[model samples]
Target: MSDQEIPAREPSWQSRRLLSDRLDWNLLRTFLVIGEEKSISRAAARLFLTQSAVSQSLKRLEEQLECALILRRGPRFDLSPAGEEVLRLAEEIYGNVSRLAATAKNPQDDVVGKVRILTISQVQSDLYDDFLIQLHRDHPRVELEIEVMRSADIQSSLNQKTATIGLGLCRFPQTKLERRRLLRQRYAFFCGKRHRLFGQRRLPLEALQGENFVSFTSDQLGGNLSPLTMFRDQQGFTGKIVASSSSFEEIRRLIIAGYGVGCLPEHLVDIDLHNGLIWRLPPAEGVVDVDVFLMWNREQRMNHAETVFLDSFRRLLEAAGEE
Candidate 1:
């Protein structure tokens, strides 16, 4: 029979077995890493593999599946339709594998298995390194998967059981979640060195009236009308808001550019204050204080490793005067 006219035959048991044996779990893992990072180089660096190896593995995975799973955009990788399906399946498969590993581990042995954490982006920048260092020192076998996102995203992840723990400013009560207060975060009003209030050690709240202001909004703060409320209700100051942003970095930059006076986390502007890049304005009343919290779902049962990690986090917060 001509090759084109020949009928397609179903694979035998032996052929099916051979194909199954050819499928590599490592390649699937590499694919998942690439999906998460969205960059081959980043995925390679995270996996501790050469860029070429990651590329080759991705190619192999696509070949084994007989379909393209990823598409390259201008400077980033995006999932194809097949890739989306694969990613969903891959997450479930890995989750099952993790559960199995956790179950198989000896109770008396070292704490092990992965802990997923969702935290505010700024909090991660400030505290993640210390937390990771301490966690590694205490339990070398434990692995951490961390996501730094907006506070709303963090809370959603916790509620959905996609994340094991969450840490951020808590302004609203969430049902079915347990919250542990970590610390009170203090905010300070600051002006750029070139601003009118720069030389003043502290300005009366009345002096701020009619001046320009910069504002920052965060999901963690929920609807707390902070600096405005402090100024209007308490201080009786009326200032025009010149700029607003969701990013604290943007707010800091705007303040540095002398756009307007802005309130910022004391920790974030300490160096700037010391260097005289920014000057703090003492409010006569109604200073902003946000309580930070470590939260987890109440319905979820904590494994030993998770319990230990939570304790460690609490201790760290206490030491930092956050708890």
Candidate 2:
């Protein structure tokens, strides 16, 4: 990819000491607000200052930096080259300061903010459940919003910084994301009660040849769930896929409703297997092992609740791993 042409900036800084002596935190904060709001009047309203006062702050910041911070006309506003760089640095500074405040809070203090999690369906695990239960008991004021999304959509959301956390299968390691293995799940082929092969045990690998199949949309993506697709190919199943879905529950419903045999997380189907609603199929020995990951955008500036919850959750994961 070609590099984007940046707006020309000043030659170079003369001395770090000189720059630090003249720079004020308030000026940088005001400029950051102007860059975000894109309007002097709006920024003044947010900062609870007069419009002229805000304009003076920006002018002071530009003069001290020896470069134009914002290029503004009668009403239109835009960030100059130096202004863009300053805004980024200012955001980083503020994020660190915010994190420090969250860190220094008393343990008894309430952590109050929302954490939006974009995840794939059927993430049933003891560790995950324990995390949630512990989170509620410790930080009752923290709010969580969970949304079930496709693997592709989850990745997109995290990249755009629209979602805070992601949990599920992923295609490959995204450079901007931080990931940890949250669970190692076993996947197995299963048939509904009404299927002819249901309840069968020790069936040969050839028995499922040309049998109809049901699966998740991700299975066809060539990225996520590559193991399931590879296993299907290795088993020599040439059957047409009768149904597919992005949701695990929907795929499970279709398979249990007798749409076709499908691969699902083994632990999630324990109750169904016990009740004879679905029966595990052949090749019982070499089940597919898929690692579910906990992922978040490295660029995102998380809220107080997010910072606290993740810290506690990581400790829980570490403790579990040691056992």
Candidate 3:
């Protein structure tokens, strides 16, 4: 046939590329949340959805899979055998998606993107200042946001893409994230200049056992379990916890006011110690080692700038550990 006489051919389905899949992927996500939480209400809360919505999603998933995924009782839910199988598949899909997302992210100098980082404890803020300085110096166009939150929220932030990185003392069971150890932060007991323990170079733990104490809530450390929790769990201390706050600034001020001896981050109290504003109580056997971690989304690929920042931060942590 001549070029002018050629017939127009229609596109075939086999040759067409689908931008979206036919299967309901959201159903699997809901299924995974339900399996992990073990309660529809809890899963709904985590998903920022209504109970009915979560239940509906589950029902839809069950219908599609042609199996009972959950057995509901009074305020509790259990996964059925079919649910267990579906869960395995869901995990595999989730893992693959995460890998794809990580692979897709490429470092670009244009279109300034915002990165939110969460901190588990104020203790890590000392290092954050230096890191921020370096970040600005390297990537002046990008905006950096930091949130000081509980460990639970930190993990949630990373999972939900609300935060790019988390610096915390506690670890959560997330199969989709990666962690880098920065340093093991140690705690030091602090008292004001006028307090009786101020003049002493070092004081024993027992010396302040009788002193009224200033303590922080678990929120300050980004975990529901605080170091003080360790004291109660292991020591069976029924004693009243005198003063409590979640802010490091508040704790510092309270300690300065001679409210009581407070457990302070070594880095935070360093300048104060040099100026004789606060004194450290002697080291004890019961000191809890706070392992500082740099948590990031394993599914998301690090860009050139992000990779450099992460590497430099890792190096700083390594240096601190050696010191």
Q: In terms of lDDT, which candidate is strongest?
A: 2
Instruction: Count backbone overlaps in model 2.
Output: 0
TM-score of each: 0.61, 0.65, 0.55
Candidate 1 lDDT over 1-323, as tens digits, reads 31112232454767567866888988988887787677889999989999989988888877667667777666666787888888777755654454454444556667877777877656634564678787898788777787777566567656645567887755778997778775566777789987988879556767776678888665212353353454444555567778887777888889988998888878777899888899888773336777667888777655667778887887877787665
Question: Candidate 2 or 3, higher TM-score?
Answer: 2
What is candidate 2's lDDT per residue for 31-80, written digit by digit as tens? 76777678889999989999989978877776667767766654586776
Decide which is better by lDDT, 1 or 3.
1
Ranking by TM-score: 2, 1, 3
lDDT of 3 by residue, 1-323 (tens): 32111232443564334313545898888878787677878999989999889888877666555457766554565666667887877766674563343333335653244555788655445666787787787767655666787666677656654456787755445687777766676666678987888877656555665677778776234354466556533544343557887777888888888888777777667788798788777555435656667887777555444566666677876776632
Candidate 3, residue 163: how far the Cα is off, in Å:
8.3
Residue 43 local lDDT, model 1: 94
Candidate 1 — which pairs collide?
A: 182-322, 182-323, 183-322
Give me the displacement of residue 24 in model 1, in angstroms: 18
Q: What is the model-wide C-alpha lDDT for candidate 3?
A: 0.66
Task: Judging by TM-score against the true structure, name the best candidate.
Answer: 2
